[model samples]
Target: MADHAEHTEQDKREKLKELVKDARIGMLTTMTTDGKHVSRPMALQDVEFDGDLWFFTYADSDLVAQIRANPQVNVSFSDAKQHAWTSVSGSAVQTDDRAKAEELWNPLLKAWFPDGLETPNLTLVKVHADSAEYWESAHSSKVVTLLGYAKAAVTGKTPDAGENETVRL
Candidate 1:
């Protein structure tokens, strides 16, 4: 029983990483000082090399204030089809890391932060994903998925969700 749980956790972590890698945008949920939960779309940075997600914001923004008041946050990443999604729950930190913020800044982001390029208020919102989970709907959701068959043929592991697993970090 313990072994099975361990394998499930391991698979979840791996899947979570993969989902995060594939999805570029996510809805970040943060609790405000007033105790209201606010959610907004954010870009997923450091995806290719790490699990830590980075987002750029104003140093004195409302979101920054909310996050500072409550560091616990939930970040959700979903693919175009929304069939695959990952939710990362962890603590968030607001820092005046201009270089890192610039590294992630682009022209598109200027629509919100007009001074993103030059404003000293530009800051980095880093989420240290402590635990995450990936939920993937079966491709066809009819008989069985083609990916399942492919996995069995290649690795000899069962391709069914009955054989599905999750992993923890």
Candidate 2:
């Protein structure tokens, strides 16, 4: 019984990792000063799921201020090819650690901060995901999938991403 429970937890972690691996740009939502939800696309940055998700952002950006005022934030990621998606709700905290920021930055981020890694605005945001919900379907057009899933039952192949997860993000 313990083994089965452990397997279930491991499976959930692996599935979450898979979703994060395929997810590049994700929507980051935070509460604004006016009490409205504001979301914008942000890169995955890196996978550090010992228990948290890591992200990079400008220290002085509006999002940072928003997070300061309200730590709660929501993030969403999707697989363009598989149409699988995951959303995480959590608290966001800004960091001033230069080493961590340097470790996560890439050349592509130059577009956001031309001043380079040394840019005074450079920082890392750690998201302690309180809970996550995932949603996926082989394809949203259910009318088209009935025949295909039936065919797979005979041929034996992997089903599409959506067949296995719930969607509420």
TM-scores for the candidates = 0.72, 0.77
Error of 1 at 86 (Å): 1.3
Error of model 2, residue 68, in angstroms = 0.7
Candidate 1 local accuracy as lDDT? 0.73
Residue 36, candidate 1: alpha-carbon lDDT: 89
Candidate 2 similarity to native, TM-score: 0.77
lDDT (Cα, tens digit) per residue for candidate 2, span 1-169: 0122344655666677778778878899999898999999998777666437777788889989999999999898887565577888888899887888778879898888788787777888888887776665657565556666787788897454343443222
On lDDT, the leading prediction is 2
The TM-score of predicted model 1 comes to 0.72
Best by TM-score: 2
lDDT of 1 by residue, 30-137 (tens): 998778899998877665233578888778888899888899999988775546767788889998776786677787887777875786577889988777766676
Backbone N/Cα/C clashes per model:
10, 4
